[model samples]
Target: MSTLTKQDPFSRLLESAPTNFTAARILAKECYLAQGIPLAKAEEYKFTNVGKKLEQNITNFFNADSFEVSEELIKSSIFEGFKGDVLVFSNGKFLPAHSAKIKGIEVSVLSEKSDLALGSIAKPEKDPFAALNQASFENGIFISIPKKAQILKPILLLFFNQANEGQVIQPRVWIEAGDFAEVTFIEQSVSLGETAYFVNKVVELKGGINTQLHYYRLQNEGKPVLEVSNIESDIQKDARFTSVTISLSGDLVRNNLSFNLLGSNSEGNMYGIYLLNGKSHVDNHTNVDHTIPHAESHELYKGILADQSRGVFNGKIFVRQDAQKTNAFQQNNNILLSDDAIINTKPQLEIWADDVKCSHGCTVGQLDEEALFYLQARGIDKMQAKGLLLYAFAGEVLEKIQEESFRTYCDTLIQERLGSKF
Candidate 1:
């Protein structure tokens, strides 16, 4: 780990990191101490400046071991069934009453007894956010899926930042899929009040040989909330991993997603859409690393920024020396509905393999005036025409959502963003 000078604010935060005699906890603490809050002005974080905001909210959020949960609040948060597939957390504490047990999968609160299992795939020492999660998280979910078992329904991990006032909350989750296993995981973040709060979350997943893992992450934290989330996954031979992230609303949201193709013939697909308004800000940074032959990865992200909102998309793809016959593609498209809206996007590729084929590009354009005019030449009104064109532009990515219920839910949010009644 690189060293940080005394002036760095994160250095002070490391001094207060919780200490434990366990090796896992010790490694996490040591990582944070050695490299606090990433290097100052690092290129990877050129657009998002989160170091100060993290320092401001770290104290009140990390120290407390517990908080209160409302039964009514929990019920209202569930838009779907209360079956065994739901896992509920409020202010980073898991609630057994709201969470039901599912069959064929082992889900337990992360404890010292199984610290070794938690960090096998997700290395906390590699990233600052991961390190903080391991060092201080009070409760987290450790999930293991058996080989050859396919769960038809998607498991939902719901989080609520209730009664947070101005405090920040951090939650951690780890998931492992056995060979030939199939599973879908969804994580949704929402809030109930207009009060300002912050959430720092960490999640790590690994797919065994020939496994199938589909992950959907939605950040619809209503208003006056800041969220910074990190997701890391390792894909094995002949395995497949699909990630769909939807960012509807937030004061400030940053998603750090990374996928490592460790085995031959592995595949990864990463897609995202963000509908932003107000003075909100959202940044997505994704990295896909291919280490073996015949691996493939694709990334496509789209954003609709209006009012004074801002959006950022940065994607990096790495092809190792041994990763021959690799195929990779990356693209980011954005639309700015207002003059005040802003977007920053970059598509980067680092290849050490000469036989691989890779391409990357980004597009930032306003709503097509010609298309809107053509629609208005018909019977549609101006506002309706604008809405229609924006929807069509965003429809491609939206069509890829596999779950019907989740797709409809995202449609409702996108309609709300477009000021549509439906």
Candidate 2:
């Protein structure tokens, strides 16, 4: 069965193009012009509408300048002084001057010939957004942690918008952790303006044998911006990788995440919570691929949609041949605050391995009326009663977060969304 009944015309252009350039600048421009912003008719883009938003010729307005960001702006968006190496990008350009170095990590801005040193990291061949990011990125941060090294502090990558005038920006990040390396990383994206613009960013991560990574992404871009992110992680044998995403703001947001278990005895976990209100739209699309034997993966995504907002969750797990003993489970649950609120959730599993255990499920409904009424009967007002019920709904996912600070931050965000003093 085909996901789409019709073929996409833009895909044809990519089929005819050459694949030699590392950045593929010209190819991306050609695709942008030929496709002229994809519509729902596009096969892979059936659920997204940014292609329609790009018709404003905003990409052409991007310009590179020797810009500098102020200290006040950095302090305003900083994520609690994480201990590991820190890389700061103001707008689209990397600011090495603002970055702090660590003893055991190698971090720098990517330029020509740097890819030679960043071994075994496969650059995408057909992803136009990846190509566009590579071509237009003023500077990209590249991190390499040596084998057997454990980072003491979480590496922070902060993307701050310093542009006085609103402009479209694309930033790229590439990371490689060697065998036996262990690290924790946190990425926070904050915009300064109420300007209307688009952000198409990509982050690629690679973990070698026996490696471990704890990754977290926090996005708070306000109401006028469109936030789109592509996060892909490749895990090797006997390795562990975890990704946590907490979505709180953005007029329209989409996160595409994928995890590949390429070696035996590898494990992966994907956890996310999104809070939506007003007329906002938040979508989370993810896939977990188990290709080797004795691999395991678990995914749970929960959302709180209020007002007339909409939320979407699509998760798929694939187990390939010879991937015996594969264990995978996926679940998506949501609480809709109003009759006007909407949620679309789909959980899927495709297994070619006969000796595996896999299951998936989803639920979309209002808060538990009994629980709300019980709280209300205990002297709680209608709004406060609903807030208590909704908070408990998302607390299951929040409890899994290991870092106390991150957990507390997410708690405060949830409280603010509920608009209750408690």
Please name the candidate that would achieve the greatest TM-score relative to the true structure.
1
Q: Report per-prediction Cα RMSD to one decimal.
A: 2.7, 4.5
Candidate 2 positional error at 265, Å: 1.1
Report the C-alpha lDDT of model 1 over 1-422, residue by residue, as the tens digit: 23333555444334555454256766877776766665337666677766655555434443234456677766777665324278888777677677868899988776633534555555776677677667666677678899999988888898877645656577878888899999988888767677666677888897899999989878888667778788889999999999999888878888989999999889999999998889988999999999999999989999999999999998999999999999999999999989999999988999999999999999998988898899789878888888877777777787777877877777777776675442
Clashes of each: 0, 0
Instruction: List TM-score per model, in order.
Output: 0.92, 0.88
Error of 1 at 209 (Å): 1.1
Stretches off by above 4 angstroms in model 1 are: 1-21, 38-40, 55-65, 68-71, 80-84, 420-422
- Over 1-422, each residue of candidate 2 has an lDDT whose tens digit, in order, gives 11111443334334444333344545454544444444567645566665655443233346334357777877766645233556788775678899887788888776633434221332333345554454455556778899999886777787876443435566777788999999888888777667766677778899999998988888778677776777888999999999989888887787888898999999999999999888888889898989999999999999998898888898989999889999998999998887899888888898899999999999888778798788888898999887777788878888767666667777787877775556
